[model samples]
Target chain A: MAKTIKVRARAKDGVVTVKMLISHPMESGRRKNKKTGKLIPAHFIQEVVTEHNGNKVLVANWSGAISKNPYLSFKFKGGAAGDSLKISWVDNQGKSDSTTAKIK
Target chain B: MNTKRRLFLKGSMAAGAAGVAMSAGLLTPGMVLAAWNEGAFKAKSVDEALSALMGSSSTEAGKIKIKAPDIAENGAVVPVTVSTDMGGVDTIAILASNNPTPLTSSYELGEGALPYVSTRIKMGKTGKVIAVVKSGGKLYSASKEVKVTIGGCGG
Candidate 1:
């Protein structure tokens, strides 16, 4: 597991806007080791979901072609200030991480 | 000079002029240098690359939004997206502030396409994730801090 996942949500006109960033390497397995010349194994996040107040707002599918440190932002309907937004993700290695954000 | 002599001289002069002009355009030093430097998409950092692509520094924040995970378990495959509500949005760029090459990717929005993009990326460590949007010839940027728990590069 990486560090703490942080999410920030702001509500305006009954819409909740959320911003998030996940820490990952997104290795493509195409890189070679300098010493043994062995190809690195492929590892990257596969999917992500953002739910605002129990409603799905954004769903993303990713691949190894992405660069390092993936970030995303989106908006959903009907969330007031102080409501919570849940974000979850799964990686290629079968590891999963989730975090929550309070509407501000 | 006689008619034949004049005609021969004119023909030789025209041929020589054509050959010289052709070589001048095809083999000039400037032309060779231009050809060698054709690709101008290289950038050393996120800021430099964004400035180069947008022709200006980006604003702090406006209508653009960037989303990602707070703590990414892996660095190689972090998902990212940028969405904006502004009209006339021309381009969007994602930057990892702490990566070796921070400028991850950029997208040019088509006329009728949605002004949003989603992609994955790798991270070396915890850093600010930036999204820069180009609209109406001005650049706007927003960033969020992402914490990396496990090492993404090698760990």
Candidate 2:
């Protein structure tokens, strides 16, 4: 599966800042289908987790209110150049994906 | 509005939608409601939802820095960042006061995680964007009012 998540981690002044974008529909289920005129089922990433060098850094519980292709960013303590940073997300439908990046 | 009353009203509204879905044979009511956090979303008051999310009504006053634009051109997407120097921060939750579902989302930070978070959220109207930080088993919060505008018409 193509990694729908894109991540970038940069270490500056002993702090690691991570930013990411995930591709997903994030349908709210309240909107009607243009053709069928029927309500669409809600589909969105419900959980996101970020890790740094094998240690958990941040975790989020999200919902459909998040716009499609959600963008998230955060900073953490103690990240060195070449440190591994990973981000993963799971959708309401149980589908999941992950991506990894190296701190610059 | 009280938390329980608002929840009940919202639940009724959801049930109405589910009724339509059921009659149309589109889906089971439970299936539709199962995907989201009904309690947090239905909450009509910030304190109501925060208490439920943070597991307490009492919060200690602490330093919580919230960064957001004073004005938003589009209500569809508004950028907000929350960060704090507080130690042992465990969770960060964002709430947009005035949105039907005030609680946008909450982050649970594990041991050794940072106390910063950023994201974009939707707003239906001009209101306060609140950020709640949980640290050392206590909740602290700060909020900033963002004026939402539509086509240059500020609301």
Please give the lDDT score at residue B120 for candidate 1: 69
Candidate 1 local lDDT, B1-155, one digit each (tens):
48999999999999999999978755543433332211212455676766665676656677777778988877666777778888877667777888765665565543343467766666778998888887888888888888877645553
What are the Cα lDDT values of the candidates? 0.67, 0.78
The TM-score, computed over Cα atoms with residue i paired to residue i, of candidate 2 is 0.78
| Fraction of the native A-B contacts that model 1 recovers | 0.18
Cα shift from native, residue B29, model 2 (Å): 16
Candidate 1's displacement at residue A51, Å, is 31
Clashes of 1: 37
User: Docking category for candidate 2?
Assistant: acceptable
Pairs clashing within candidate 2: none
Q: What would the per-residue lDDT of candidate 2 be over residues B87-113, giving only the tens digit for each residue?
A: 888888898888766788888886655
